[model samples]
Target: MDIVQTQDLRKRYGKVDRVCDLSLHVPEKKVYGFLGPNGAGKTTTLKMILGLIHPSDGGVTLFGQPMDGKNRLSLLRDVGSLIESPSYYGHLTGLENMVVAARMRGLGMAEIDEALGAVRLSEAKDRRVREYSLGMKQRLGLAIAILGRPKLLILDEPTNGLDPAGIQEIRELIISLPIRYGMTVLISSHLLSEIDQMADVVGVINEGQLIFEDKLSALHALSQQALAIRTTDNHAAGELLTAAKVAWQRSEDYLLLNRLRDDNVARLSQILVAKGIGLLRIEERQSSLEDIFLRITGGAVSL
Candidate 1:
């Protein structure tokens, strides 16, 4: 079942279109990765869904209810979000900050320990927010967000400034949320690799337009397979490939062919040998999520 749906969702600032005609469906109890490059309007679209900002046109539905001005307040009670930077009192301790959040959300103090433990911040509860590392701060933010145990958790660029270990920690935590707490997640990130690891469903946006939205497995299956061939005489091999009408491209040290099958590879090898064009190496290459993202977004490689 879809817990969130949007139809022709659009957001504009002055003459600039931040997001345009985006339609999305987020399944229940799944991690939905909102993938895009910087300034692709990912944050804007997220804000619209959270009702933090209104769409210029179109609409959003959460939990089968229309997300308009009337129902936004009540609807937001079931949503927990951590957008951009996580806010905290610099002078307050980790536990102290969580206590503040708990008070604001009408949550019990026991939830403070539970949230901190979930993010593995229990040991650092007494540490001042100013002294915590970037990763710690992020974890604290996540703890605060999940304090009330909302059904939907929306995190925007949650792992933006973390180290490798930190990123992995957060990735594992996000992936575990749906299983452990039955929460549906909508996470936005520019990093394809990160989304590739954590998302069950992926929605890719470019220039404010959602270019692709589907299951992660479906996205993987869309990637094209190619064979890279290195020959002693690449020029001759190119000529032969052109004559045979094979779809191929010349790289710095290899020729990449798109339509190469197992039998075709053998035939090409034979043809190269027959023509005295020495075949050095031939290897099959599968496109990665990064490759697919770059291709779909017209080489937007910022992430």
Candidate 2:
């Protein structure tokens, strides 16, 4: 079942559409990677889903029910979110900070400890939040979000500005959520590599529109393979390729051809050999995820 669904949801500011007709299906107990480049309206789409802002068109559905003003809050009661950044008192200890948030929501202190521990911040729970590193603070925000053990979690650029280690820490924590806590995660990020590592499903948006949505493996399958050939005499190999009218690109060490068949490979090999160009190596190279992303989005976003 889809824990969250949006049907042609749109958000417009002035004459420009910040989030166009967008639909997303987030399955229960799965990590849904809401991917886009900066300024691609990932946050706008997320906000509309959470009812943080009203959509100019269409609507959002949560937990299999249509979300309206009447029941939006109750529907979101089982949801936890850390959007943009977490708010906390700088002078308070991490534990104290959690205490404040818990009291505001009428939750118990015991749950705070479990949340902090789950985020691996229990070792420094007594430290002042002002002294916490950016990573620690981010983890604390995560801890607060999970305080109620919400069934669904929404995170916006959770790993933004994080170091490699911090990013990995958050990645592992997110990956464990569905398994350990039975939570569904809706994580948004501009980084394809991050989503590649952590998401079971992916939704790609660009220019305020949903471009692609599918399983992580399905996205990977969209990448096409190219033939990479390294020959002893590259210039000679280039000449042969030119004469054969085969479209190719010559890098410093290798020549690249697009999706050649087995017979084409044999034909090219025979031609090169007949011309005394020693083929040192030949291999197939799949386009990277970044490459596929750029292609899918029509180069609208960088990284």
Candidate 3:
């Protein structure tokens, strides 16, 4: 069942539409990656989902119940979110900060140890938050979010600005939540690689538009198979291949064709040999997911 669903969700600011007609499906017990480039309205969409901000049109449903001004808080009781950044007192110790959050959430003090340990922050509980590293601070925020062991966890760029070690550490931690506590995680990130590593299902948004939504494998399959070939006479080879009803493109030193069958490859090799053309190289190639993402977004991410 869908733990969270949004229908034609839209958020408009003045003449600009930050999020437009987005419908998202987040399945239970799966990690959902809200993938988008920076400023593609990821945060806006997330805020609307959380009911922290209202959309100009459309609506959100959490746990099959539509959210509104009345039942938003109660509906969100089982949802834990760390949007953008987690707020904390710099001067306070980690445990002290968690204590405050526990009180706010009406959770018992024992929950603090559980949450901290889950995020591997228990050892740092006595350290001043201000003295902690950036990664430590992020873990602390995550600890607070998981304090009551909510059924759903929403995190926005949780690994943002962290080193490789920190990103991997957080990624591993997020990946474990579904089985450890049975959480359905919704993590938003501009970095495609991070989403590729962490998400089972993906929703891609770009330029305020919901471009693609599917399982990770579906996105990977968008760019079909191909063959990359280079010959001594690409100029003549292009004509011969074209005459043979083969489609291809000139890329650097190779002619990239939309996948030829095994028999077709053999035929092409013989034909080239008969034409007195030296076959330099011929190999199969698959389009990378990153390339497909750029193609689908029209390179709008760079903007």
Question: Which candidate leads in TM-score?
Answer: 3
Residue pairs with backbone atoms closer than 3 Å in model 2 (clashes) = none
For candidate 2, which ten residues in a row score worst on lDDT?
A: 294-303
Q: What residue runs in model 2 are displaced by over 4 Å at the alpha carbon? A: 230-255, 259-267, 275-277
**Each candidate's TM vs. the true structure?**
0.93, 0.90, 0.97
The TM-score measured for candidate 1 stands at 0.93
Q: Per-residue lDDT of 1-303 in model 3, one digit per residue for the tens?
A: 999999999998999999999999999999999988899999999999999899999999999999999999999999999999988999999999999999999988789999999889888899999999999999999999998999999999899889999999899999999989999999999888999999999999998889999999999989768899999999999999899888889999999899877998898899999999999998888878788888899876431
Clashing pairs in 3: none
Tens digits of lDDT, candidate 2, 1-303:
999999999899999999998999999999999999899999988888889899999999999999999999899889999999988888999999999888867899789988998999999999999999999999999999988899999999999888999999999999999999999999999988899999999999999999899999999999888899999898889887888888889766989889799998999899889888889999999988889998999876557
In candidate 2, how many clashes are counted?
0
User: Candidates ranked by TM-score, best first?
Assistant: 3, 1, 2
Cα lDDT computed for each candidate against the true fold:
0.92, 0.92, 0.92
Residue 107 alpha-carbon offset, candidate 1, angstroms: 1.5
- The deviation in Å at residue 197 for candidate 3 is 0.5
Predicted structure 3: lDDT: 0.92
